[model samples]
Target: MSLAPILLFTYNRPEHTQAVLDSLSKNKEAIDSVLYIFCDGLKENSSEENKSKNKLVQQIISSENRFKEVKITIQTKNKGLARSIIDGLNTVFLEHEKLIVLEDDLILSPFFLAYMNDSLNRYKDFKNVGEIGSCNFFACGKEFPTYFFTNMPDTWGWGTWKDRWNKFNEDAVFLYKELEKNNKMHAFNTYGAYDMEGMLKDQIFGKVDSWAIRWQAVMVLNNWLCLYPNPSYSNHIESINATHAKINMVPPLQNNEPTFETIEIKELKNVTEAMQLGYSGKGDYFGKLSKKYLKKKTKKILKSVLLFPLPYGIVAFFKKNKPKK
Candidate 1:
């Protein structure tokens, strides 16, 4: 088996599982790498048949790909997403120094594997880089072929070494209370503060459950730079009412093309470059769509167009034009 395994997590959604696996099979380095499949056990409210059918998801995830780069971890009891990922990762790390992770829904480019492996090897020793990501949400504005930047961390296609994974504070013993007292919640605004460690306190206290938000918080607070592509590598798979997206912030692609990559090992400037790229693209579309009534991104720009009273503006917009009350 290869030293690094392509780690995959799957639940229900057999079709999505199959689609992502198909994409992985097409990836440039799939033949040489090992695929470590972690199939989560049956969930609550699911009938026995549904539980048994859970095998289908696993099969779809690992099916027909019995090559050098394929391994399976089937859980008998349901561990949930949080436990499964953190614990599954622990298991994977025991045998592999580095891991490339993916969920059942995510699709990747052929170069995605190549890029992630390259970054892992190049930045494995870079103290500031906690993770090497295969995805970024930035619009590839005025693409200059390739570039690098830091940003809010994503839980999509990503790779990391055992060193950084070991550094993760599972207990979150140090930073949780401090992050709250300092009013630094804004700093960890990848998706929202709901994803912040602020919300993870309950999960830690046996009140709730989650996985990724806290991990992102751990990585971000430690001053670790999460490397990202300009146009994003793996597109989100669970877009419509799937498990992950809470508010359905499925905005249209602003500048999806002209995606950026890293041509060489270079010191990153700051997270500003990626944000700048995204902002400029949206800004251009804001003006570009002002005249056209049906232009995309107009709704997004206008949704947050108001300055103060953010909640009120959003509620008012949603409540407008009643459906025959």
Candidate 2:
């Protein structure tokens, strides 16, 4: 079977870029599979240190020849991570029907490429299968199947066909309105286990710029299922400078090749419950309390502090000694 093209997005993280590249190059299919590197340009007012790092990243990419074909696109202007990914996907879909994607901070197992290619080929024509996710964050028991389906799409390491990606809607306003109007917010949040709805709202309000949230919104709206491997074929590496500061529990990488099978598209209750529990702050006392009450109360207090005309000294003291509860 033909291998799907791999697209790697990078910015100013040279060390991370090199690490991920080395890991991906170890894949059995790396020698024959085509690879594309999209290096985003430095932002406006970027410091010289950042410029140096970006240049180092480009240099590393340019010197790489591990793949059968290596294509590089160094942007002249900053497009941010969101725009860069959207544009990169569009550009690749023009030539290839499907492709795998990875960010600069992800490490892939040797069998990652094999699993992705197999799944892509198996589900290429299945309209219900929107994408193949390589990372499984959900805590599953040993009896859980090798693979399962969910409405949520993971971005850490994933692949999708042009047809499925073509339906991706980036309009945050439209997606929010539709979900709210249809009363699908609960399902969209994975039954209140996650703050996906809040993330979408943040995207709409300009508080955060996230392409993954928008992509998930599309998947949720269309009732599309993303296939996830049990022992995740990929894992994310946390970086101090990364946008997502929350550290995720990386599952053990798949040690051997997994067999792919055509299965009915449906969410597994056990897997769903596991995912909800994982995100619902079950074992942590502070997590449950914060999610259930502290967050809302804190937000209200902050709003009052910002809007109320209070003495400067008093406000400063209040902020300095903010209650930890």
Candidate 3:
């Protein structure tokens, strides 16, 4: 494909969605891009949560500034996040070889799209690169703007090739069946306690779900690397409202001083090297368990002691209900 398609997943959060779109429109390069919006339908009519979905649809219709090129997909029925994403991706892959995926709550810098497309094109021949990710949450103590290596490409704002997308098991409804009964899903080692397998457990057994983590498991099984920005190419605006986010406080990293932009292709080598060392090949089981348990305990203490007076939980709840447009 001459250009990479951007796959946007949205539900009822029109304000956040609108903010995300605004960020996209202000990008340094917009005319050559294609934005494909996947507006999910309500899961069930008269459902209480459909109020947000209704507003999200209104925002999409109200947006006036058109990108260089844009295509939209509106589902008549609610397919839920996981299904809507897996299905929307399948359709996009039919037309484009590469795609950059974004959600309503994440905002990208002017160079985010450009960086992703260039990386995808540059690494198309390399099977080791499973995806392009801009969600740089950690401070790697590096001097450059970005880095890459390995990690399950979290879907906050990511890009991938059609070939890799096809490899994820989208029809994993009976995930528990495959895990305990049948034992077909592959497991990869992790240096922390939160490997793909535990993610699956959290989904099926722990009352959790997300298509991205499952896809990460598949990438891990295949032993592939996911590139990340050094200073983070994208920032999570939905941190307060995001259900899947582990850290839901006022972002310690939000600001407008340093311009976020992509650097020359010569820098990709450093990114690639760091990513490779980020994960263990065997799904570091003990580390995964340790990280998860420790983080859980820490969050509990933070909520009860350090962050007690602020009504953080209430604020987060309202944010969750806030419009995405």
Per TM-score, the best of the predicted structures is 2
Cα-lDDT of candidate 1: 0.64
lDDT (Cα atoms) of all candidates against the true structure: 0.64, 0.86, 0.64
Reference-based TM-score of each model: 0.73, 0.85, 0.70
Clashes of each: 2, 0, 34
Cα error, residue 300 of model 1, in Å, equals 13
User: For model 1, how does the per-residue alpha-carbon lDDT over 134-189 read when each residue is reduced to its tens digit?
Assistant: 55554343442244645455577888888888877666545576556655555655
Which whole-number lDDT from 0 to 100 does residue 99 have in model 2?
A: 96
Encode model 2's per-residue lDDT on 1-325: one tens digit a residue: 9899999999999999998999999998999999999999989999999999999999999999999999999999999999999999999999999999999988889889989999999998888889999888764447567788987798999999999899999899999988888888888998788899889989999998889999998888888999988788988887777766366545678877577777777998877777676567652211123353557768888988788657975878889999998
| Residue 72, candidate 1: alpha-carbon lDDT | 83
Regions of candidate 1 where Cα sits further than 4 Å from its true position: 1-3, 143-145, 172-174, 180-184, 190-198, 201-208, 238-241, 247-325
User: How would you encode candidate 3's per-residue C-alpha lDDT over 102-182 as one tens digit per residue?
Assistant: 888877776676667777787887777788877665324433343546545657788889888878874444444444353
